[model samples]
Target chain A: MKKTSVFGPTTALAAMVANPLAAQDAVGIDDKVNQVFADLTGPFVSLIFAPFPGTSFPWIVMWLVIAATVFTLYFGFVQFRFFKHAVQLVKGDYSDPNDAGEVSHFQALATALSGTVGLGNIAGVAVAVGIGGPGATFWMILAGLLGMASKFTECTLGVKYRNEYEDGTVSGGPMYYISKGFNELGLPGGKILAVVFSIFCILGALGGGNMFQANQAHAQISGIVGDYPGWITGIIFAAVVFAVIVGGIKSIANVTEKVVPFMGILYVGAALVILIVNYDQIGWAFGQIFAGAFTGLGVAGGMVGALIQGFKRAAFSNEAGVGSAAIAHSAVRTKEPITEGFVSLLEPLIDTVVICTMTALVIVISQQMIINPETGSYMLNEAGTAIATVDGNSGVALTSAAFASGISWFPYVLAIAVVLFAFSTMISWSYYGLKAWTYLFGESKTSELVFKVIFCVFIVIGAAASLGPVIDFSDAAIFAMAVVNIFCLYFLMKLVKTELSSYAARLDSGEIKKFTH
Target chain B: MTVKLVVGLDGTETGDRALAFAKDLASKIDASELIAIYVIEWSPFTFQTADENAKRHLRREEEIELATSRIVEPAVSALRKAGFNARGIVRHGDVAETLDKLTVENEGSQIIVGRASADGFTKRMFGSSTQNLVMHASVPVTVVG
Candidate 1:
């Protein structure tokens, strides 16, 4: 068995059997950094991921999924109720051109979409379907549907408790409201939860947000060109990211805001084309998904496996329960906080329900995953659920292979898309990490600069390192963010409900002004 | 009767020319108040993270202070040195709309703006604020070259 630093001998052996690259990537931060990250984060990952004695499901995923189910019912399915109003809000039907926040409802939605509409839609979906099989797609869609209420609940509270300064800019998310809302309600633990949330936010920003993006981007780029060391990709990616973020040029940021959406449309449009071309097989693919979800066909762990994979990917994909999007959505320019909440419901609907579903459909319809025609089972390694690839490929490579089936040239486009998604996601997370950093350390210019530099350095670490354990730990850190933020969300949901009712009443009475021109 | 003349600050040669012209007009008019106003073009519709937006809010305040010291304060001081009642206020929004709002809000009698040199695609794209002010201002607008 090929031994890697972070992954134990058992995981390394299994991954090596599934993917040869796990054995081949020799140049990684497998020495000191890997050990340190693992030492610090390993126990937490184990605890958070500890499955029920008889099941393959992790408890943390259950935390988010169950909470989503609860919020979905408690909010009276606000995700469905406000569905049309959310569209109208995005169209600016009720915006008073004179409202006092930093961004329009549309811009806030677009910006927040950019943050979550990254590797999750492309690579994460592949990971889900790779392990869970086509049946997982059904569960994913269901989770995304329920997760919409989770997003609506948190983001509404985001706007209601946002801190609007004298200069017309607003700062918020779960951090502001978690503390403030709980304090108002005379509940204790707001301060502690907020502090823990920020700490996890910074770690998440560094790991899943930064490292994972860089690592995946390196994977895609190196596949096309000859394999180079990951640090080379890391440096170039970090330099460009540093310029857009620290350089503080309006034109550059403006171009990024414009470019990210354009890229998203292009990626989805390509998937749509493939789906259209394979229209006849679409019905058959749905049949397999539904059947596979229930019976799991010959898939390992059967129905339970599909359910777990679907819920996990969908939660991270739209980030509905994670509370990160609340930070971005909180800046919407409207006096009625519920308006932004309505706009935010569209985030998961697009990221998970729309885009992620598209990816799942393409993967399913492409017929790329080798199914033993005789056995009606996905061709996979016996040791693990991973679909075996030529070079032991997984993630984006598997997704790329599926796309390449119909359009031979699409992998090149996907490579470009992956890089763009990675870059934009990094930029978004840099800001998120910085806010949390400044929150913990004083918000001085020097403290912020120190955090920025440290963040840029981790990009290199992520790109260069093939430490599987480090990546796992990073994923755990990110989930930990949801743990803390969602706790606050449960408490502050009452505040959001209050705001929603008031905004609905005002709308019925025609109290809110609409900008016509 | 004292008249209030609002001059839009553009921070260009034309802006300087408009200010000089306004100074002369203020002197010629029997009793007049010349208000030098600089309006920053800001859109709350731009996509930015909460932290960036918060830092940007702080930056705008600093910019307003800097603009007052570097642009408006000198012009106002020059107007005072040239013998006139003058004050400056900096606001943020679409330049034309803000200047128009300032004139109405401050009860100015007339508006004077520099003819922006921007033309071609940029003019079509962004639309010259000077042109908008001339077209939409309720008060009489004097376009200074």
Candidate 2:
């Protein structure tokens, strides 16, 4: 007898059995859409993600890394110097009682954190470990640390140049800073750069920020709930997203904001449990990660391969130099723009350093990577890729398998977390995309609705098919945003430094006072 | 001797009854004053999305206006017209804490609040604002049931 499952759509099952052609056609659609998207996005994706000459390293990854390194140097390692101060600011120790109505630094950080700390941590880290080998973990941490400076530089500009309307509402991001900061510096083409950034922000919102999230969520759900058409999940997600963004159902967003943090805590708790269970193997896992980072553990491309993957996944996960987080941080209620900058640095730390590391460690300690004793590296197959215990799986599936290996029921909890994370990310990105959309098209009800509808449609497309081209395009679009943003950051960074020094002088002079409650 | 009374208002009938009780108590005492306070329960730590967070300042302003004009000021005006020295205060925080703080700041001899109906399961599980004020206030609290 055929197994009955609630997750299996009865109509889809009956149709597939009654006519095998229908099943074949459904797969064909998934592939055909992927093929068409690949053709359309290929040139752009190649251009943005092009590898550096004679290396597998993508130039975009290098762009982000170099920018992070520059910011780290330019700011004199502010991420390290003021790390303690950043925590105090977030704790509201420096906040004045008079600033009660304004958005708190903690609120800004949490909003930005929700946007960055999603599938990238759960799935992106898995792909990094799966392909780049355990050694990638070291570079990932390094990138996250360096990325903190990048966040500080951009977010400071975001707050400084934010637009405050008469009604007391605000709008800010790279667009404002690029145009305004450039003008302030007497630089030409600031407006043009800002326009270019808005274009990429819209595309990225639809692709990486919306579709990629939707796609991964579907992948995790289908992995657990039995096979069903991706469109079903896509449509459901799209509908709920539409209702929240367009229908003005704030309750959903409120509920998501309340729930996602709990889910994040649950995810970390589960990871801690798994680590405790493998307590004896913790040191061994760290050794594998550190050794694999340098030696490559027989993984493809050796040490360099691990480095590229580590840097790539870390940038994708934390989104430090990408400038998306600055949009969220700009809303912070602080008289000193650098306070938001200080607070914003914590996003990469929590997202990549803390959460992504947790994911990577779990995968490493799960016994997924078989060591080749002869080579003192990971065992590889004929395909020249390290063999994973879970064959033919990557992304959240790999992470899920790792967690399930620890506690058999962790996959269910992981599935719920993935959906919530995806949903919350979409909500935050919808606002981000809407801001970009309005910046280009002007803020109007009609313009907002148009962008919201377009965003929801992409969610469906992302869910309906296996998206190789879409994923590539999404990565490209986001990197393209960095290209414009990091360039502008170079121009505006001096201004941010000026703001920082002024703030420091004021604090030293006791012009800025800390409050205790 | 002069007596000062503080009335916690929620803009509801229960609050009106509490204000009336406080008003009568003030009238009976020579050289007494009434302080009507309305607190909008709020915490900065609650999770808010970027959109909501962006508009938080505007929302806070609107809430203060609403509580002052619609709840606190109107009630205080009526008390003032009745020949009593009355002033209203609006703040954001835990209801019980804000009221207790107001009482302390105003140098009130007594605090008065309506017995709010059990709001929900959580409110019932934890005591309501009046119950909390009665338990923790620095001054004598009068529950105008």
lDDT of 2 by residue, A161-227 (tens): 9898878788999999999999999999999999999999988888878877777677667666766
Candidate 2 has which clashing residue pairs, if any? A135-A293, A297-A377, A297-A378
- Residue A487, candidate 1: C-alpha displacement in angstroms: 2.2
Superposed by TM-score, candidate 1 places the C-alpha of residue B109 at a distance from the truth, in angstroms, of 16
TM-score of the B chain in model 1?
A: 0.94
Candidate 1's DockQ: 0.26
TM-score of each: 0.80, 0.93
Quote the true-contact fraction of every model.
Answer: 0.39, 0.75
DockQ category of candidate 2 = medium
Looking at model 1, the pairs that clash are A19-A392
The CA-based lDDT of model 2 is what?
Answer: 0.84
Q: What is the lDDT of residue A470 in candidate 2?
A: 75
Candidate 2: segments with Cα more than 4 A from true spot: A1-39, A373-376, A390-393, B1-4, B31-33, B105-109, B138-140
lDDT of 1 by residue, A1-517 (tens): 0001111223223333444675455423265666887788789989877887898888877888888899889878888888988888887677664442335687778778889997788888888888788888899999888888888888888878877767566667777788899999999988788889888888888888898888777776766774666778999988877776666665666677777788889888989999999999999989988997887755667888888888888887887788788888876656677777778888878988899889889888887777887987877765766654444545766778888887899889888887788888888888778767776786677998898888889898888766667777777777888989887888788887788778778878987656563
